[model samples]
Target: MAQTDVDSRNAQFWDELCGSGLARSLGITENTPESLQKFDHAYMGMYPYLQPYVTDEDLAGRKVMEIGLGYGTLGQLIASRGCLYHGLDIAPGPVAMMRYRLEFLGQDLGDRIRQGSALEIPWPDASFDCVYSIGCLHHTGNLPRAVAEVHRVLVPGGKAIVMLYHRHSLRQVIQIPVRYVRDRLSGRRRFASFGEAARAYYDTNAQGEAAPHTDVVSRAQVRQSLFRQFSRVRIDSQNFDTYVLLRGRIVIPRERFLNNLARVLGTDLNIVATK
Candidate 1:
């Protein structure tokens, strides 16, 4: 089944992001190697570990699936590495954009990229050598179900590389007061618990509106919920204070001291789990 019960607000939010030109925001200009490199530079500057994994020699000839196709830079990079690439996204706008980008690259993606939810991937069981999701699963309606689906689709000994937002990170800290005020303004009285309030903090978007589900999970949540069924799990993180949330734009360049401090208080939960 196609996981169709996603929150309408989330779908509309992504549609808006696509219409607003997601690639344009991060300086992605044209569909050329130079532009991809430029996007990669800005992208990896924030993620840092994406390049090494996507460009690894092991990816050659392997069947891989990326859960999120952001701007198609990493998708192009993966296809270039000779992986049989399949991408899934909840929004049709990004899927259309990715198809157009793949066609521009002289390789017609055809049906490789599709509008589908991560909660229940429309692929068969044990059909992939690896499944990768970067900073995408947490924004879903059912995060635990999404991770379970990641576990289900992988062949025995296959790997799932997923990224999530860190609860104890600088990003959440900065958003707490912002979310509190936003919630207060919206007429929400008091938070049920610290975790629920923190989750609200992560979901708050200063720039207009945001996806309905922008959640943050702790390392404990990963071990218990996100990667509970995996045999071996490795967790890592990067990017702390590179950008600050503000009006009109969500990110603004910050001083080196703050960025470096974010390193100590990492924001991402880089997960590598063996099925």
Candidate 2:
């Protein structure tokens, strides 16, 4: 599909179901202060590594731009840490949510939030000291172009922290193939191959609809192509379900074993790069 068509499809998908549509299930039914707090707690519960990786102390006084405003969780944290927090998203739903979140906190940073695409970041060259995106760039359809745009906007020696899906993840390696076989046998959908099933599974939301695009990459692919412009890059794999092999029907018995396994097989490829 063309980039413009992909962008339009993503915009429509996110605009219709803001933040993966997980808010309601996580006890966030309204846009109140209480609901926002609930979402932050739930979000951290799901991705505890975020707090340490995206530290407020390091970003206390920097010009930081977040490429995606998922329920405004990280954007609010960035502003509260005393950083100049600028945010952009492909959909108005998240942009508005982030603005409302800032307003509710009395931060008055609504003007800094805009609705746009990651393919062409609407910022000047060397405009920011830090660019942060989590679980966003991989869905942009053109990961290399998005990364180049990120590099273009960051000043020399600036930092960028992004999270992309890992192609070598446990989800991709084992669970997806099993899922493909099961679905194909059950006649749920006609899948030509495992590759087609993997793409559909990864891009699907809770509503069972797939997004326009999603990309997964190995560390080597990222280092060689997506982030080649950066002077330094570090990629770490994290985030995995204990019962992934069993589809979470039963929890895995060993915590230490799972932690060790997640280091290499975790689905999220957290990239910390310096441009």
Winning candidate number (lDDT)? 2
Q: After superposition, how far is residue 96 of candidate 2 from its true place, in Å?
A: 0.3
**Error in Å for residue 173 of model 1:** 3.5
lDDT of model number 2: 0.82
lDDT of 1 by residue, 1-275 (tens): 13354545556556543323434776655556576667667765655556776665388778889887766667777777777888898777667667766665677566778887887798999978988888779888788888999999999999998888888786676656666767878988566545556654444333534446666778888888678899999887665554544664776554353336654567777788999
The 10-residue segment with the lowest total lDDT in model 2: 250-259
Q: In candidate 2, what are the lDDT values of residues 107-179, reduced to their tens digit?
A: 7574678889888898889999999999899889899999999999999999899999999998888888877
Model 1 lDDT-worst window of ten: 14-23
lDDT of each: 0.71, 0.82
Each model's TM-score? 0.77, 0.91
What is the lDDT for 80 in model 2? Answer: 80
Taking every candidate in turn, the Cα RMSD to the unseen true structure, in Å, is 5.2, 2.4
